[model samples]
Target: MLLAASTQRTIGLVILAIVVLGGIVYIYFNIRSARNEVGSEIELASNRKPYLSDEDLEGKKLDLALGSSLVLLTIVAITLPLYWLGEPGRHEGRDLDTWRISTNRGEEIYLEGAQCVNCHGPEGAGGVVNTAITSSSGEFVAQVNWKAPALNTLMSRHTEDEILHVLNYGRNGVMPAWGSGGGGPLTDQQLEEIIFYLRSVQISEDEIRSQVDSGVEAGAKALILETSDEAWAVEVRAAEAAQADAAMAVRLLGRADFDFECSDDASECLALDEANARLTAANEAAVEPLDAAVSTWFDQVSAAKATADALVIEADPSLADEGNEDDLRAAALEILSTLDAFEGQEAYLQWGEILFSNTAAAGTYSCARCHTYGWSFDGASDYVLEENGRDGPIPELADGYVTAGGFFGPNLTGGSTLSQFETAIGQSAFITRGQAIGQTYGRGGSGGNGQMPGFGALTEANPVGPGMGPGSGIVFEYPALLTDEQIDAIVAFERTL
Candidate 1:
């Protein structure tokens, strides 16, 4: 049986070979058949016109094949690269690009629009919002509650690391944590860039100190703004004349030579009597014009204040008729015109009061004790012994009088305020100044210079500074830290002042 099966397998293999040979023969015959059909078509065409040679036909076929190959290769080459290049990972989002642009240190970040000019100022030098920060008692203080800190002097005092920390972590409730630690919106690198920009700011402490020290002289000049430049020149000439008159009075008064008088009754001496009368006349004549000028200036200030008050009341619906908002606006314009008439009178009066006052109060100290009050190009004032016997030159008064004892109160007479003198300067300014001074001077737990006293819980909306706000006798003995609205109101009022 095995031998019979081997024989059958050999027969099957021969048959399979024969079938393969037959299929090849059949395909060869079909190719020849197609070539014959093409030849027939060409023969018919040749019968009608000039026939193509075999060489030319072979050349055309070769060219067609080569062109098709090249076209196929080109399509594959072009598409392969394009398919790979169009992958998702290659592109980034527009927001990411925008963020990169915004975070660049050299670029200017406009918070909102051109109106940023109105507050942040040209280079962010203590804008309308931040200028209100004051130092008192060695701590950083703010007159208003929930106010942003100034960026101007921050570079001078704060380290880059500290600034970055603040930017990331924010301050109090008002300043949000802008760093990852506080779930901030900005990335760590963005925060660092901001810090770098802030650190680059350069502010002159010397210039600020000089300005603070010159408060008195600035006040004196403020008083004479109502007089025209020509009038001022005339006044100057009058002042010179007064000086001569004063000199003449001194010479004629016989008081200059009181020691030479031999009369038992000096009053009975005719020469002395005549001299006294002449001296009195000259003194009176020299002072008359100056007195008149001062009176007129004050009158102008009073009138302007009345006009401004009226306008303010009209603009406020609570104070005026709500139905006449437009009318109130027109009225405000009229008031502004009246205010313009007064011109520099308000400043002059304020400055005069600051210059001549025995005691000054603002924020936390006396201005007279720390600045000069008289006129001199070189910046010094002569000592005027007050009627009460207080004596010191302007430079002497400015030395360390306010900060000497470490807790000297500031003068607020000529400073900005919110409500009345007591509310604005006494309460608000003092609290803020005390906080800043405390931090700067190193008097608080934070451990700073300790040059001034600390406001403690009083620095915050709730009690956070020492002393619990300013003392009693003026406004509230210890008022709460000011609100943002109150601060704004105070600032608005201060700008007017």
Candidate 2:
């Protein structure tokens, strides 16, 4: 109430004052009037002359006493059962009120108390969080913008209990543990309230699809707008075309024709060497302009993205009802979408590499944490060890560290992944559902717990009945670990390993 606008608060205060004064006056007048009426009646009775002799007066008194007793009996008979009949309804009403209060508190925690909006954004929409990359000892390293996933659609991925479990324990190093058991700030009840808030913000599947489709179209528009400059666009297209031609020229030049492995004195070997050198020089020359063009295009894209981000911020609303879809649409269409040379199969594998290593979620959870030994982070670091005082600097790995090597998890290198899964779909499925406790997965893999999180939607092993307890009417799906496209990319990358 204190945070309300000045005009609104003033109006509220005035109204409250009026109500309080009115109630006081009403009670005072009613009490005074009742007392006055009783006094007047008593005085009238005391002053009245005797209506009969002693015997007649006694008889009249007896009759009055009997009449008063009968009236009192009749009033009790009507009211007693009514009060008892209303008891159960009153209890149910109290329970409902309690739930409503808890839900409101949960919203408060999500918006203010827990500071979830810093990463998740308003109404549980995902957003980018800019923070400094720090070592385990709290030394500053570099700045990074981490991507937080949307919580509004969280139910489509995980059940309420699974979400509750995550709330209790947190994930990776990015998301701090929130429950008391994990030594965070919130209690179990408070966490539940946060979940309730999340429940209220969910959108329909049709709306989600529409938003995604609109974004794709908008992205294409932004791209065309950026590259619409005649001179720059023409230069970019020419450079790209030249690079493709150079690449094809290199491929067409057969290795057998340039076999320098033959005796250097041989005439054919000398001729082939000269030809190979000329082609290599031509390819290198073509690459230079291509690189410059790509750099310029990337800069433009970055600028466009920054503009879009600003628009998105303007559109963001704290409450679902206040959201401005027009602003969101404008922001989504700010950047240009372009065709990439590495589309189709090549793109999937490349994307997988990014997802495998990217610290998008709270700067912690990623595939490399378990699968790759010393890839880019200290795989040994865990919440349990950190709590037990095993604090140390997180050793940073050099770029292109030995990927797919075994660390905390199994080795995925040297065809090990392909051998286990047999097919890409198998690999994808394994990633989607993950391994349950003591459940066998893949070829000869066993004794696994639910350590490997699922990337797609998951079903609960056991769901509660509608009347299991309070709030049982509410249901939730297990949160997805990854999207289908993302999982496909990871699977492709793993196969390469």
Q: Please give, for residues 96-175, the per-residue lDDT of candidate 1 as tens digits.
A: 35335544442243233212224434444433332222333434332231112245444433334445566566543335
1-497 in candidate 2: lDDT tens per residue?
Answer: 12223445455556556655775797699768764222322233666884565466557797799679857855564455445545545655775676677668888998889988887888887665565556667776444444566676666555666676668777555567899978999997898788767877876665554544343333333343335455544544555555545433443343325543465665554555656565555445545544465455445534544444454565564212345554443333321111131223333344455567654332223577567754333333332123223343234543335666765578887778767876666677787776655678888888554556666775543233212265434334544545554566566667776
lDDT winner: 2
Q: Name the runs in model 1 displaced over 4 angstroms.
A: 1-280, 286-296, 319-368, 371-497
- TM-score per candidate, in order? 0.25, 0.45
| CA RMSD of all predictions | 29.9, 19.3
Per-structure clash totals for the candidates: 54, 12
Error of 2 at 459 (Å): 4.9
